[model samples]
Target chain A: MSVLQIFRKTIMAVVCKPIAHFWFGLNLLHKERLPENGPAIIIANHNSHLDTFLLLTLFKTNLLHRLKPVAAADYFLKGGFSSWVSLRLIGILPVTRERKRGESDPLQACYRALERGDILIIFPEGSRGAPEEMSNFKTGIARIARQFPEVPVIPIYLQNAGRALPKGKRVPVPFVFTAIIGEALTYPGDRAEFMEQIRSAMAALKEEAPQLKWPEQES
Target chain B: MSFPFSLPSNTSLTAIVLIYGLLGLASLIYLFQKQRGGGSDELAARLGSWWVIITLMIVPLMLGALPFLLIMSFISFVALKEFLSITPGRMEDRPIVVAAYLTIPLQAFFIWLHAYGIFLILVPVYAFLVLAYLMTTYGKVERFLPSIGIFHWALMTTVYNLGYVSYIMFLPGGCNGTAGNAAIVLFLLIATQLNDVAQYVWGKSFGKRKILPSVSPNKTWEGFIGGWATTALFIAIVGPMMTPMQFPESLLFAALMPLVGFIGDVTMSAIKRDLGVKDTSSLIPGHGGALDRLDSLTFTAPLFFHLLVFTSYGPFAMSCS
Candidate 1:
């Protein structure tokens, strides 16, 4: 591992993991379904800042060195200290949220990372939404999956994160959240169908672990 | 300060050795049973984990007070994590969560510093108010009361109550001298754990009536009374040598241990039932989670600590060099 990766691991083990475990009571279900080797993409519903931390804690320590989360550059890499934290501490691949005409592809960094056999975590919803509800998925995940058909797209449903550390909240509320990893999917040469497949897979996961669902969803 | 290895002349080395010897014998019996095709894998795993747990518990005692306190804090952190992982609450209570996590180290630090005033009220008073204030700032009113209530209870039980175990080392020496404090902690641990095992063994062998069929089906009147009587007898016999307590006080302490421990175990069970989880998490091999192992300790520690204090056997009762 590089020195930065080592440092990141240390901080994660000592500080982040314990705090997350203590506060959110995080549980990762079906983690064995995660691909062990080669390039893979993890697509999950996003509702809290805790989405990435919850995802990171699920992987074995050794795999962490090869994992990079796809974060919005405009938010995470705003400048200075945060940029350094986004790049070094958590190893985020910043995808620009907005691009001018003739600008480079925002997902180019993600594609290069996948080419190098790194696991990329993508929030297909594109931004945080209300707790227990999902937004319409952006087609970015489909584009990447089609480009690299060999890379398995693993669908995950992050339950209760929005309630744990909802948008506009720096600290997380002490709530137990779950990361439900669904079966992996490959590109079927139809982008819309693929995105719908991923979305429905997550929706199915929400039903499977209904205990993690919000009270409103139950009603 | 001298290393704990120095073994103060008054330290109860005999009690320590006898306990481990009993554990060794139990392991041997289990092994022999396994050879006869009678032992289950779950029992074997439980015993295996017990060996690691026993060593972890004893090493810190041998290292001295600071290490013991730090280890207790770590245990509290794990227990709290398990409890929180099973509880259902809001996402907006992040501030309260941070405050609760921060309280673990702060509570341990208080014990280390022997700041009795702040240590006693930190969670029940200050933390309670701080969490309330934090919840208000979040501006999300849904399930607000229940969320704050859970947070407060988690901190109180996990951090505040468990933290009392470390304070035993700081207790004033009574008839056995300063080293007797370690013996007091060892006594509580032995009695609490023995009560748990004895209750299980007796319940399995002779139990017929359920004590609380709704909360815990496994618990029975036979087991409750049997475990209580046996553990109390053990404490009464061993108590004079290991603790500052005399025969009668030891008997009282013994009786209280299992009763409170029963409460703690069932309380966690009720929470688990409410949360719709069988076990808190599959963290430990045979044991369910850190919370499962610590359920008895949570209630016993605070009660035992207060009993010592009320009986004039705590740190406040005597002076140290």
Candidate 2:
């Protein structure tokens, strides 16, 4: 094995192994929700740090398959071995959310990854929002759906990622959690209409678990 | 083989006795407190068990036995028992054989003897293969493979990792000075425990951002940063006092130690979730069972041991020299 692979595995063995050990509490509400094959976008609610690994472990796929997680450039890819492992070894695709005017858009990296038949995980609630309700989602996901209208967009509601690793906390309180993968929402043709459908679908997904109270319905 | 602190001295012995006595009393009181409310028996149980862990760590060291091996075997046995108790095993299964429990003590004994070669291989390779062969000899039942595999891996990870504590204790030049030995062991323990406490404190106090919402709900960015900051500070401060290493180096080691320990804690949390249980067992009041207690130690032991082993000496001569 290459040195990079060895280092990645070693770090994963030490760090991610525990995450897998602790948070396998996920109950897939709809296994059939995921497409059997082809490129897709997994749009989920951002909650805790555990979101990355837990989703990776719970998402349906052959054990042999690999999925790329699109994480924030500023946080997940923070300096040192932590970043290297997350991006390179764990296959997280980093995207910069905020940039100066006329700068490159972050979604390009994700758009390319999705085109390659790789699944991309996106948190539409720009960042982790309040526990009671999801913040207004950024239109990035809708735009991506429109861009790759052919690819399926899987709506996933992570029941407790927010509570597990709330917005500002470091330590996760051990609790039972489930990653509910709702039915896939394909890119509806109209830009405005499609955004509304996706938002309602995500909100409906959040309702399945009464534990999370979705924010007031946005018009 | 004699420990320096083991020598006779009434003052030192009395002080040791008083300390342990107070701790034991506190544990009992904590146990009683649990019974009183009629609501906190679980916490009481955990706290009571924490006494034993603390005792094993502190009392023996105070008495000068340096009973590190004893503690290792005990933790291994306890954690293994916790694993087996939760997991069902058939009486007829050879891997579930009586010989397995017996091996717990023997493997511990090998570790005590510092037999690295035999100790490491005994579980994963030899014992595992033997158990599998025995299972095969009985003919393959449909559910047999997975059942045997889980049992074997659980035992191997729990018991073998426990044995590794011995390897850690004997790391060459890792414990050169009297103070150095105490510092290293204490530093490891403190880092592990402090990581848990600090994370909880941080998460509880200032958590707002959600990092992973599904697996562990209470983890937060605020808590992570605050806990990490405090832990790093503690590491820097306590690192120098406990070891021969200078401030920044000790600080760096301390910081890494807790991060590693945090990983260990979460790993066990994940395992418990898979098993569909909480707190491993009710063996400890106010704390979880042995598995919960040993969770951090399992990862911490290997990490701390390896760090010392590699830094102090080459891989080839880690245990023996």
Docking quality of model 1: it rates as: incorrect
Give DockQ for candidates 1 onward, in order.
0.20, 0.01
Which regions in candidate 1 have their CA more than 4 angstroms from the true location?
A1-26, A29-31, A73-116, A131-136, A139-152, A157-166, A169-219, B1-12, B18-52, B81-93, B98-144, B177-179, B201-209, B220-226, B281-286, B310-321
| TM-score of the second chain of model 2 compared to its true counterpart | 0.77
lDDT of 2 by residue, B112-139 (tens): 5656668768888877887777777767
Give the Cα-based TM-score of candidate 1 against the true structure: 0.77
Q: Name the best candidate (by TM-score).
A: 1
Compute each candidate's TM-score over C-alphas: 0.77, 0.50
* C-alpha positional error of residue B37 in candidate 2 after TM-score superposition, expressed in Å: 12
The local distance difference test score of each candidate is 0.79, 0.65
Share of native interface contacts present in candidate 2: 0.00
For model 1, residues B1-321, the per-residue Cα lDDT tens digits are 855354633555776788789889989999999899899888888988888888888878766677888888878877776666566656555556667888999888777777877888998999899889888985899878877888888898899998889888765545456546677788888888988899999999999999999999999999999998888898888877777667777777877878998888889888776666666655556886778888888899999878767764436534432
Docking class of 2: incorrect
Residues A3-35 of candidate 2 have per-residue lDDT tens digits of: 766665565566655555432233346656866
